[model samples]
Target: MELTNIGTVRDILGRHGFNFSKGLGQNFIINPDICPKIAENGNAKKGYGVLEIGTGIGVLTKELALRADRVAAVEIDTRLLPILDETLADFDNVKIYNEDVMKADLRGIIEKEFAGLRCAVCANLPYYITSPVIMLLLESRLPIDSITVMVQKEAAQRLCAAVGTRESGAITVGVNYYGTVKQLFGVSRGSFMPSPNVDSAVIRIDLNKKSELTEEQEKFFFRVVKAGFSQRRKTMANSIASLMGIGKSAVYSVLSELGLPEAARIEQLSMEQLMKFSVMLMEQTKE
Candidate 1:
């Protein structure tokens, strides 16, 4: 059955006496085309393992299980287990766990279930937990090859935003350090049951093996980026001075050495420029 067949989903939930919980973000995708697109973009073929979050009504999970060798879907709402079991019965490869994705030990789960197979993450993420969930997957010790998620349109733009753009912020810079991000396509509000107030977009994050900096350097660079965006209206120097407890004169000196104007805002610096500024800050501290 395709995801667009909402009647089936409704029937299954009705049988189990399940009520959609607003807190869990229980919006079900009723667009069959989106299922295949998400699976294809995630590159989840046979022999690959997939970690799925927020598997509401098993619409997307059914599709993922068909494509991937093994699919582990973590759902915080235990009430939906029977419903998922009924909907996803034929797929022996699918495993449903009743736990919060944030609290689960992903490394242990992957090691025990997936073993040596390449892994990808797929989700129709809740708007509230989207940022933390994506960050958790990217920062995990597991071998996550890629991530394809459906998030609110605004959130998607922020994730794929380029440095020096209005949308760029700490999350944008942080994601860029780990991988390449792209907005795949947008989904209309009407495509989902109990439709969201806003539209959503699908995004892909391809992990990178070679980082330009050592672990320490990457950490320091992000620290600076976070501090830079801590006060959006303040100049970059003022923001860094306030966050890092450094003098405004010293911050300006570092910006001058990097050939950036003294009045430049934090939004004006790219990830590369941020790293260079971090190095200059270290040198100044040493002097």
Candidate 2:
């Protein structure tokens, strides 16, 4: 059977009486070439373990299995299990895990399934659950080499947004603190079985091997980041002051000490500036 063919996918679903869940944000990629592109851009390697989330009909999973030493494809939809079992029958390296990624013990599973191999995350992530999934993977600190995901185009832009730009959000800042992010490619809405309203794009984030940040400093950094981004239109100092329980004058004083304008918006600061601000704030809190 042509797994990436829409007719074949429909036939498989028909045989099993499987229905697409709107709540699940289900969209299966039906383009054969697209899967290989995602797998290649994700850096799936001969000796690496590729973690695949949202394995719709096992198209991308099959592609990853061809490259990676092992592929742990996690699917939340129980109905697709039989279809996956059939389609992935030929692939010995692919293992399907029937579990919710949000609730799974990912670290434990990675340790047992991946073992000594380097690991990367590759997924056609659901739009509704994209942020938490990506954030969980990043914060898991699981010795991940890279995270390559296909998300909504707008989301991809916000996630891989350039520092010091309005496109950057708190999530973008948080993501950069862990890895270097870049846009891999754009996948159109037409590529999927059930076409979505907006287009999608792929992003690749290579995790930083080392950061010049202490654990205590990291805590303060994110705290400040959270506070600054609490309100998008507000000035950085004002927003941070409101959320951090500090006086606006004190916030402005620190900004002036760093040679920043009192009117600077939260999105205007780069990752470097945020880190520097975190250090100064840490000193002030200590005093």
Candidate 3:
């Protein structure tokens, strides 16, 4: 029942007929170093409740159980439940839910399972569903302390990229608004049972800072961000105008007031600059 051992993983999967689902991003880690490091990167200290998503055969889930007070893992693929049961049978602290993390009542789950304990999220996020999953976790504001995840190297770079860089996408801006991200370590493409084409990197996101704007303002601010990034090829004025449903002249005026060029690209603007400009634009449209 040693989940990180390649022979054990193969044995369990073969017994259950558990075929990997590319759509689910089902690449299970066989590297003994990777799973423990991922759990460590999660900051799963005593008394902390760690929630894991995509718990393939309960590998990382088992690691979290050793470090945290409670480990709740979500696995959308029910086919792996028997495997997880066999692998995780010894750990009394781990709970594997045959449920989708996105659709589950996270707040309620946290409240019920993690009462009096600090919460953190640790996952090997499914690549195709990464954006929505991260967005849901951030927006939930579920009294979580940190989020440490393993993502494709490119995605890792994009998520942790500095603001005002062209590497910053809408998700980058959105993630930056919510938490401070730091790169932890890289896992070679060869670390998995069925290796992914690209190497993966682990990143830790601490939910330390709160945005200066209120929730409603922040909502509209992200709307402005979407507008800014809507058409990368277009000038700021053009893109913002089209998405914000405002006039190009008005957008130009707003940029002028902000001391930015009307032709500025949204990706070139920092989160602070985006927030300042978006607040102004939102106010102007109201008037």
Candidate 4:
């Protein structure tokens, strides 16, 4: 079946009585070139297992199945299950689960489904849940090598943006803490079956094999980072103090000890500086 062919896609979904759900952010890719690139760059290969978050008409899922040793996907919309069954029939390696990726047992899935194969993730993520999904995958600390997903172009910029830059936000800091992200390619808005208002881009995040911080430290670091970015216009010290209920003087003292100005903003601190600041603040709070 030509999954990317618009007519073929419509015929299949029509036969299955599938209607796109606006709330679900359903936008199936109609571009033939996009899925193959995602599969290839997403580390779907002979010895790899792939966990796909959303299988839109099985376009990307088929591509992943073709390359990987095994494919397990979670699709929230039950309406697409029959459509996926029809589209992915020939691939014995693909397993489709009707569950929310957010609440799904990802670690259990990785352990049971992947076994000896190196695991990776690939998805055509819904724009509304993009940040939450990415953060969930990262914070889960699953045994996945990388995550490759197509998201809104603006979101792609922030996700792949350099930390401490103007384009960076709290999520940027969080993403950088866990892995390195890079934009793979851009897909125009017209590439989808229904087409979306914004263009999209595929980005890859290679997870760090080992993290330097302990679990408690990691949690506190993100709390500080989130607080610092909560109010963009406020100084980092002021924002962190206000949100975290720490005295402003304490935050200022930590910044001063790190050779940073009291007026420093979240975007002004490099990842290294931010970590050092977090550690210092933790000590200050303990005192």
TM-score of each: 0.94, 0.96, 0.97, 0.98
TM match of model 3 to true structure? 0.97
Candidate 2, run of 10 with poorest lDDT: 246-255
How many pairs collide in each candidate, listed in order? Answer: 0, 0, 0, 0
Tens-digit lDDT track for model 3 on 247-277?
Answer: 8877787889989997888888888888888
Candidate 2 residue-wise lDDT, 7-109, digit = tens: 8998999999999999999999987878999899887888799999999889899899989999998888999999998899999998888999999988887
Give the Cα lDDT of each candidate: 0.85, 0.87, 0.86, 0.91
Q: Compose the digit string of candidate 4's lDDT tens values, residues 109-227.
A: 88889999999999999999999999999888889999999999999999988888989998898789889999999999999979999999999999974677878888889999888
lDDT of 1 by residue, 1-287 (tens): 55468787777777788887888877889878898899989978887999998898888888888899999888999888887777788899888889988999888878777876889999999999998898888766468889999999999999999977889887788688788999999999988998989999999999975677777776777678888887977898788888888788888898888889999898888878887888778668768
On a 0 to 100 scale, what is the lDDT of residue 21 in model 3? 90
List ranges where model 3 is wrong by over 4 Å.
Answer: none
Alpha-carbon runs more than 4 Å astray in model 4? none
Q: What C-alpha lDDT, on a 0 to 100 scale, does residue 47 get in candidate 2? A: 77
lDDT winner: 4
Better of 3 and 4 by TM-score: 4
Q: List the candidates ranked by TM-score, beginning with the highest.
A: 4, 3, 2, 1
Candidate 1 lDDT = 0.85
Root-mean-square deviation per candidate: 1.6, 1.3, 1.1, 0.9
